[model samples]
Target: MAEKKFRSGFVAIIGRPNVGKSSIMNKLVGEKVAIVSNKPQTTRTKIMGVVNGEDWQIVFLDTPGLHKPRTKLGEYMMKQASEAREGVDAVLCVVDGQHIGPGDRAVMEDVARMNCPKFLAVNKVDVTTPEGLMPQLQQLATIGFDEIVAVSALRGDNMDKLKDLLSGAMPEGPKYFPDDMITDQPERLICAEIIREKALLNLREEIPHGVGVEMLAITKLSDKLTEIHANVYCERASHKSIIIGKQGAMLQRIGSQARYDIERLLDTKVLLKLWVKVREDWRNRTGDLRAQGYED
Candidate 1:
């Protein structure tokens, strides 16, 4: 029998804010490498997740949601999304199946100019019927796509099919990542993201987007215990108060929720200590964005 050639390449997943780009990438990679939230712009940078098949490896770049930049942090995020599309084997543009709006159109148009094979994933199909998806499909038909698949990132519907299409798009090449490895994100960054995800889930609407988590220190206290100190940066003192909550209750809630996920991710007990600090318009400040790991 002839030997099989290994295939591997990068695929950038880009879409408008709150379009479930992270959710789709997580499902495709079969792991939660990026954080998810109901809020727009939950992801602040390009997160890479690697999927290894028997003879193929797919490197998925989960980029931040494409949106207008209002601050330096937003600009960095937009730049990350743009840079992720360059030098890739394919581009996977995800969009909401239920509501195909102008923002989605804008994203599709920008991606249309890219010089690579493009795949459109109409996500959240579980919530809508085939009939309900018609308008979205019709709208998407105007754009050029190599393949379009309807999927529910949360329900894993048609995920295997989507995976196959993505893997098939790869040219025969080297395995970019090992079989056991899933993501390229560092432990500190992942830890910080987990904390941020928890905060986004629990905090008020206006508070989550302005929030940034910085890993002050991460220490291996013992073989079974890891100590993580993080600072949750908000733009104003009032926002800090809201994050901390009455009698430090809200902060405690975010810490407890984050510690659970961190422990699972690290496979060790974690002592996550979080402190809420006000940086006064940190999102617009270049130094603050750099401090929060948003620098590009």
Candidate 2:
């Protein structure tokens, strides 16, 4: 059998908060490697989602949203985003089709310094009209990108073209990940993120950004059932009360919702037990942040 030449490399997706960076990455890799939430800072670490074609592979890097650091956790997130650009084959500066502000400018400036081939991925075109999307296209030209791809990660619009563009940038190399691998993240991390995603979806806007989920233990008790114990951490005691909700209704809801997703991911019945804990100033403490899987 004649072996075919392969192309594979890392491509970092850079953007400000709520610009669909995680959504775009999940769409490209065809899996939910990174959690999605309406609130900012949903992705705290660098998640690499692998996309394998017959002839090429694209390792997509989903990074934390570029922002000014307010605590140790925030500093770690910002550092992860910066470090993700260091040795990637290409960079995708994903942006919203409509609002481009100081935050977007800051990300663009940082990505420009990466010294790698950069592509402007204008996302959310489905929500905006041609007139609205036109300005985003025209405005991005001044930033100097190797290519501009308009895509709606939510609807999968023009995603194939975007994938082709990224694959075209891949250099001749061996597959960095196995063909069946969609992400490099551990199953435990995915479970934790799923719990956090449910919390973010059900909790209030004020609580979503401060919440983090830690997978205490996950074990298969039987071939058909898996047991998982996790703790949801917050910054204050009052926040913990809010998470637990009145009469523990909120916590039950979070557990119920998270279990469904976890079961789907594991393809087995799940016994998900959730506990709300108050890790006072956890985001600022190195020990607490590391426990939540946010460290390097």
Candidate 3:
């Protein structure tokens, strides 16, 4: 425990794209509330995961990674990342020890003006050499952080120590969630993210960025099963063709993989149906972005 009294507060997890920010939060919270991929900008919004210790509760807000804005969607993502730091108890800055550069610095610049204490976490330590890790630590030291820890979000290295650091940094406050509650995200939103995660993992580089999933319908058939209908939107017809694949093999693979994950998340059998639609530059269109739940 941070103190004898109970401690609870919001902690914003911010970092450059694909630096294991989501991975860290998911590992701490002990569930996959956030979708993770090797691709940059896989996380498009702020997702909250609650961690409950014996005497403390930490609500971790996993925000989209910092990236250069290329469209309204990108703009919304960066805006969400910055907005997450506001009125929070602490800001956790995650950086890849093996790869630290302008993107990581740009992320720091976004949160530099925040009044809350900042904790720098160097992730991917299991693969980082002492020589490779020291420079990142030294460079980050120049940025003025309240505390720093080296961790591996992938292998659960030093997570206990990191959790203790975060707990100690929070002020004594009331619990924000029950001990059993892990996340507050809507089921439909999580469904969309699971589908998007599968696409991100299966599709080519160019296709994943243009793809967005929408939950059309979801209903419980029985106490043990759920049926979900969703649409995968793309910017062009060619992209739709690529997503559907020849003889619909690619689409089937995506659906099978996503269904397995959704079933686990919902704790019930999932019957997921997917359709592809061409939205013609939906990433740049404000209405399309709003309709798809990427509100700005």
Candidate 3: 10-residue stretch with minimal lDDT: 105-114
Candidate 1 — worst ten consecutive residues by lDDT sum?
A: 287-296
Q: Residue 80 of candidate 3: its Cα lDDT?
A: 93
Task: Give lDDT per model, in order.
Answer: 0.90, 0.88, 0.89
Q: Can you give the TM-score per candidate against the true fold?
A: 0.97, 0.96, 0.95
Tally clashes: model 2: 0
The per-residue C-alpha lDDT of model 1 at residue 199 equals: 93
- Report the alpha-carbon TM-score of model 1 versus the true structure: 0.97
Error of 2 at 11 (Å): 0.3
Which wins on lDDT, candidate 1 or candidate 3? 1
169-223: candidate 3 lDDT, tens digit per residue: 8899999888878887888999999999999999986888999988889999999
| Candidate 3 Cα misplacement greater than 4 A, ranges | 1-4, 109-113
Overall local distance difference test of candidate 1: 0.90
> Residue 242's C-alpha lDDT in candidate 1?
93
Using lDDT as the yardstick, the better of models 2 and 3 is 3
